[model samples]
Target: MLQAFESAAFAAWPAQQSLDLLGWHLRLDRGYTKRANSANATAQSLPLTASDVQAIENHFRRSGLTPTFRLTSFAPIEDSDRLLDACGYRACDESLVMTRSLAGFVDGSEIAFAPDAAAWLDAFAHASGKRGADQAVHLEILRRITAPCAWAVHASDGPSPACGLGVLVGDQLGLFDVATHRDHQRRGLARMLCGGLLGWGARRGAQTAFLQVVAANSPAIRLYESLGFEIAYRYWYRVPTT
Candidate 1:
């Protein structure tokens, strides 16, 4: 199940460039989010060696980005983690992938749906307070998604205080980029928006919903738990010693 979600996530949050080498998926996206810029093991049986790790590092260096690896709990990468540790790689930004069944879920909020990718990007930027290059790259990623997607906002009549993204891969709905404006914190905007996205997915025949959140974000974790999501797996990034 984790592997299936891994594939869906790579598709849902695609990078600008992707290369498959030695049973690993290497991605690059202008040094943006780690998920889009890190090397990830594609299978459990990959025979990754220290030399392969060095080659991966050299590839990223040539691209002007730091070489990073996303190590998942389920992907036993032939002691690659040990090799990275030996090479002075530090682990950080551990995150949890939470999932829930959409069966019998209910959401009745009058949530607003963005008409297009650009509109959704605008709402997301406003809610997330992200501008300039972040928004530009995010828009490109959003536009690249070919799966059925939903871009939702808290309100339709005016500027949205909260926004979210949902990408439906087969029967699973992958939630991403859920954000609420700083001024609107503690008002349940995120909850409502997420509920709305889940409801949309359910209506579209989605059977499961999943989302990724930083493990250190206690408040967000609590909110996701309240929404019936449970930790399905954990993944973290390994960065070179600096």
Candidate 2:
């Protein structure tokens, strides 16, 4: 089931495009977030021999992207971590994949679906603190998702906006781009957005809600737990030192 989400999340947030190399899904989205650009090696069938590793690096290098791999608990290739370590790849950004059932949901009035990509981008940028290629890459990725999407914002009565979030890939309703405004921290806006989005998904016939949060983020993890979400699995990125 956890493995299913790793694939579902990838499907929901696809790269600008991707390639299948030796049963591995090599996602390419310029040089944006690791989640988008890194290859998912959970399904690798080959032994990840030295030549295979070098070829993977060369491919990403030529593609103008750093070689990266997203490693999960169920990766087929054993010793992937040792191989990555020997190759000067460091593990980073360990994150938890969480899920919750949608039984008693409350429709959130403070949250609304983004009318257009521009509006969605505005709130997304504010919460995530990303722009330029970093931001543009995600906008393109979001467009690739054909599922019913809800780009939500925490509407504030005052002038200052609180935060933003996105619920793409329905039924599963994978949550991504969750962020809080830089100026607004520890204000519970994220909690509001999360509740609102989950309820919003429930109304759309979504039965399960899933999201990825950095494991190091204690506050965020605590928040999710308080909301009845439990960790399903975890993943991390292996990136080249250079």
Candidate 3:
């Protein structure tokens, strides 16, 4: 189930565009987010040979985007990590994929379900510190979600949206781009969004929920632990060590 969520989450949060080369997904979105611009191993059927590595590197370099690889535990290629090491790639942003069972309806007060991309985009930009084309790519990504999406904002305090998140995917309720605004750091806005989203999921027939956060983010990790989330697996980026 964790593996299923891993793959489903990737599909839920797609790039502005994508292409499959040699059975691997090459995601692109003007280099906005790693998940968008990296070379994904989720669907690869071929082995990761040195030649394939060069091809992968060349493919992204041709478009001025750094070649990146997201290696999940369930990746089709088993020796991917070793191969990347031979190719001089180093790992970073080791993240934990966590999940929990469905909870009752969380009072999702001030959590506005977006009818479209506009409201969510504004909140996303502020929460994630995106600007210019970086921000524009986010909007484009939001439009690509085909599942029953709920782009929500936690603004019970006042008119300003304090934090935001997009719950995508299906019964798994994949959470993506969850961020809190700078001014709302110590508050419990993120906690609200998670519980509320879980309730929203229950109402929509979702049985479980999942999200990924950097292992280095202790605060976020602690928060998730308090919510009954446990480590399902870990993933990280393999990039040129240079």
User: 241, model 3: CA deviation in Å?
Assistant: 3.0
lDDT of 2 at 13: 76
Clashes of each: 0, 0, 0
Q: What are the TM-scores, per candidate, against the unseen true structure?
A: 0.94, 0.90, 0.86
What lDDT score is found at residue 179 in candidate 1?
A: 92
Q: Write model 3 residue lDDT over 57-110, tens digit each, in one string.
A: 887898889999887766667677789988899988888899887755455544
**Candidate 1: worst 10 consecutive residues by lDDT?**
41-50
Model 3 misplacement above 4 A: 20-23, 43-46, 76-78, 103-110, 156-161
> 195 in model 1: Cα distance from truth in Å?
0.8
Order of candidate numbers by lDDT, starting with the best: 1, 2, 3
The global Cα lDDT (0 to 1) of model 2 is 0.76
Highest-lDDT candidate: 1
Candidate 3 clash pair list: none
In terms of TM-score, which candidate is strongest?
A: 1
Residue-level lDDT of model 2, residues 22-101, one tens digit each, is: 77778887787888787787554455767778888887888888899887866666576788889899989999999988
Candidate 1 stretches with Cα past 4 Å from truth are 45-47
lDDT of 3: 0.75
- With a 3 Å backbone cut-off (N, CA, C), the pairs that clash in candidate 1 are none
